[model samples]
Target: MTRKTLLILLVSMHMIFGPHSFAQQRTQKPPLHAKHWMAITGKPLAATAGAMIFQKGGNAVDAACAMIAATCTMWDTLGWGGETQALIYNPHTRKVVGINALGVAPTGATPEFFRSKGMKYPPEYGPLAAVTPGTPGGILVMLAEFGKLSLKDVLEPAIQMADGYPIEAETANLIEREKERLKQWPYSRQVMLPHLGEKREAPEPGEIFRQPDLAATLRKLVEAEQEALKQGKSRKEAIYAAYDRFYKGDIAREIVRSVQEQGGLFTLEDLARWRVYIEEPVKTDYKGIEVYKLTTWVQGPVMLQTLNILENFDLRAMGYNSARYIHTLYQAMNLAFADRDFYYGDPYFPPAEPVRGLLSKEYARERAKLINMERNDPNIKPGDPYPFQGERNPYLKLLEKWGEQQKGAAKSDSQESARSNEEFEKDFYAGTTSVIAADEEGWVVSVTPSGGWIPAVIAGRTGIGLSQRMQSFVLDEAENPFNVVAPGKRPRATLTPSLALRDGEPYLAFAVQGGDSQDQNLLQFFLNIVEFGMTVQEATEAANFNSFQMRSSFGNHESRPGRILLNEAIPSWVRAELRKMGYEMTFAARTSGPINAILFDRKHGTMWGGSSNHGEDYGIAW
Candidate 1:
């Protein structure tokens, strides 16, 4: 992330509710070895390594398993033991099945759990904040059901990486940033604590660093699984034992003990009783294209809703990169995000708050009405449902002030407006990395791994910090319609992987891990391609903008003054036009998340894959 975004995040964290968030990211160029009928991810070296597993007869699923496993080693910025959400594109069925390998709130979880324990919502860094990790569980389940290779094959690269590598520019920076917090974990400091009694510097650009313990863990999984198989255990049994070793087994117990020492809440039972959530992925149709996203417990539906609102218009007619087009997108995002904040929550445990209705044509049409081709509604508020139905007036609400700001809508004065900027500046600090890939067998994968930031690394388990996802819950149980804090209820999330289909056939598998920025970029990128008919490369290269003041689930725009940030690449003329139309602007060419995408042009029978150069050069192999 650029300095501008980091500044914005500072304000958002303080004013947006919940607590401040930490970021973990890397910009290593992905290795160039996955172009030919193979699976790939964010890190070139890691993805290339996984693709090699594919060449060794591993299927696409096995390859993803390998990439994620390897990623846990080299990409320590993201937790070696965190959660993930996957979108599996199956060609034979021409249908997408969402494998929700996300972590769940503990059976003992509740909003008051933190409040009572004096543990703030964002529990700085500890087991109290950690949800059961889903990366290991999710990958294994996915591989066993869809992949043809064994666990050992999937885990090899990660094991090698953990054993050792030299520090690179990105990794070096991350370690330097977290050095203080990492001192507590022997394994963590052992790997990140620079050289022999000397400090480590940023690798010139692409350098390597190794983690022996992490390597040992990966090796343990493969070795134990291999032994289980030899012991006459069935594949399922062997896989289960492998998972146990990582979680309930020695490794997991060691982590649990360390967490307990740090006054954390992960119990032996919590680890033993933990289970992954399984739910149906959501589906929607926009611009004659069928789209699928994770269930509403995430931002994917809003992506669909935002697209639906844009579908009513021909973006090409608006002209590509025109100020008018940019303004239109901002308006659509503002409206869609309004619904997202109001209604989106864990369907399993919605807050008592009124149920927000999204994806309904009636709901979307009402949102589109707010868009004015000639004007910018900077003083934006959720408009009545577009294609307005006077009846079925569903009431959706969000916190406006500490007091009774919830009675209805409240207007902000010049003085109040000035304070909005101070409050929302915190949302800009997010940093993340993601990758997208597909193999010849008609399988596509996307992995956006983030958690365990640099500052307050986790107390134990190698200086890991739990993901800040717990922030998705509301303090007032009554405010959340479908988001009531509860045991096992997954928080509504922004990290959703997406798949786009042509004539109902899967053609695109893409994902970006930008937290709040994810929705904004996804909206612009998809609309630029679907409605405007631009290629994936063109869409990614085009300039993008986000309204920091725009109201959404993230909170009110009042937190920040009239601020809408744009990429430096956008022409001055366009910026001038937007300013004329009433948008306050900031500039940053680096804010656009590295959008990794694979476009299968069935019409041409070729795979055209490209990764953004905004922060990292993507790796493409064939």
Candidate 2:
């Protein structure tokens, strides 16, 4: 055929077959398909650990525990002393469960104490910023309650890694960058910077990095479990014995001594009193799908609240990533996050969070009515949710004061007052890593574990890095009454893992890294699949916008209203439209994620896995 004839033939075929009919949709990374199980997390090695567990006949919860342990050992944005928050879908109970393993402020970690130190919020790094360790207990409880394997079987990979593992370039580079801070802590300096006075003190990329202390510590837990088992203790009792070893035995003593030596506030009682709570998760329904998140302690509810407000609009009709859709989502997010900044906090604390009112559909409808369809509302303030739940707004005066502060902030948000782009983005997308696991047995688990990241202060001989979650607390009641620094109280954290159910069955389990932006990226990832009909891989790789309108949970807890981030693929016309809507736009080559997710393809009796191409997140399936 002649060239012109061939061209004409192709054009005719295009007209007949439609755009997507010609071939499978192209994605940066291929989606994983599995029949029996799937395991995904922030690191390749950690995902391998989960795969190993699955191959051993372990359930989803078992694999998740293994992956969490391995990631903590590798310092995949966290360490042994960090916090853990998870949402598990139990096949037996047929319900979503929340794992509240977040560390608490130690004794003497009060607002007055921090203010006396001449700080606005708690310090961002060092011993003073440490919270009591929580992950060890969290992992133990999950394994004891839901897993089918022994603690030794689950922790083998992590213990092996703790002995030594070839460090990835990303983590090695981060260590070098933060070496100055690492030097301040003797144990950290000894472990992270082996070369000492060399120009490049951190581990070389792919270098075998060993932590003998950490390996020994892990072995002690196993020893405790074995001792209990030999005594004819039940598996659950054996695991709790290990838990006690970490929290109240020799491990606890070392941790407390090291923390105090480094000028931290940890005490024996703080470690002994901290307990993991396996509570009922909170959920909201949208279009008959129930999405679950941890309660008010973490930022998970923000996504639910956003979904509630968005239920009032026809989001699919707006077209995906179009100016109108982005604008609408941004406005809804700002509104929800405004309530989050003010009201969402530790539910165990007094001046209890009006979560019932905040999550109410009626409150969402009222909040949605305030959205300006034509432009962004930078001055959006927290709505009064108390009345929606049959109560008066006790903090009305404080809310009014906050509103005035918001206006003043908007006015003064000039280039001079704004943080440097580098600094702003750093805190905006801080530490955390996600774990997603599912099995053919109808079990599913999603986890967002974080804290004790690079530049962490390693506690003396224990080799555990202290949690810096104290920075997430506000030092004054006026800033956030429920999140004020206080002993035994948990901070309002940014880590969130999400799960969705349809027709009383598992639909999706997803989570991502990015402080404060965790739910923002997750919301878009969900919409890309449900609203736009993208495959799991396509949804993860899709371009998504970010609104920096919420007060950051890190650093100075500042909010940059009207500032937004967009993927570079956005057309100039869309950018122009958003700018006209009063947005201060910034662009990135990739925006949506490093998200890791497992989609339960119930209709096909298979699992579909997605890991974003931007990071080292990986998955294995069988």
lDDT string, candidate 2, 406-454, tens digits: 5554455443346787798898899999999999999899999998988
The stretch of ten residues in a row with the least summed lDDT in candidate 1 is: 16-25
Q: Give the TM-score of candidate 1.
A: 0.83
Global lDDT of model 2 = 0.90
Task: Put down candidate 1 lDDT per residue, 1-622, tens digits, no spaces.
Answer: 9998896655433222111122321223332233356444556677677668867887667777777666656553466656677787766766677777556666567767767875324343545555656677777777776777788777777776666665456666766765666676554565566453455532334555655566666677777788899999988778777778876887777767776685555666766666655556777777578888886677677688777787777776666556777787787887766566555676555432222346666677767877887777645554444224334434434333322432322254234344444345443334345656677777877666555444333435433334545555555533434655566666666677788887876667677766677878777777656655556655565456776543323322223324687877565567788888877887776655567677777766667665766654345456
* lDDT to native, each model: 0.62, 0.90
Error of 2 at 57 (Å): 1.4
Error of 1 at 552 (Å): 8.4
Error of 1 at 322 (Å): 1.4
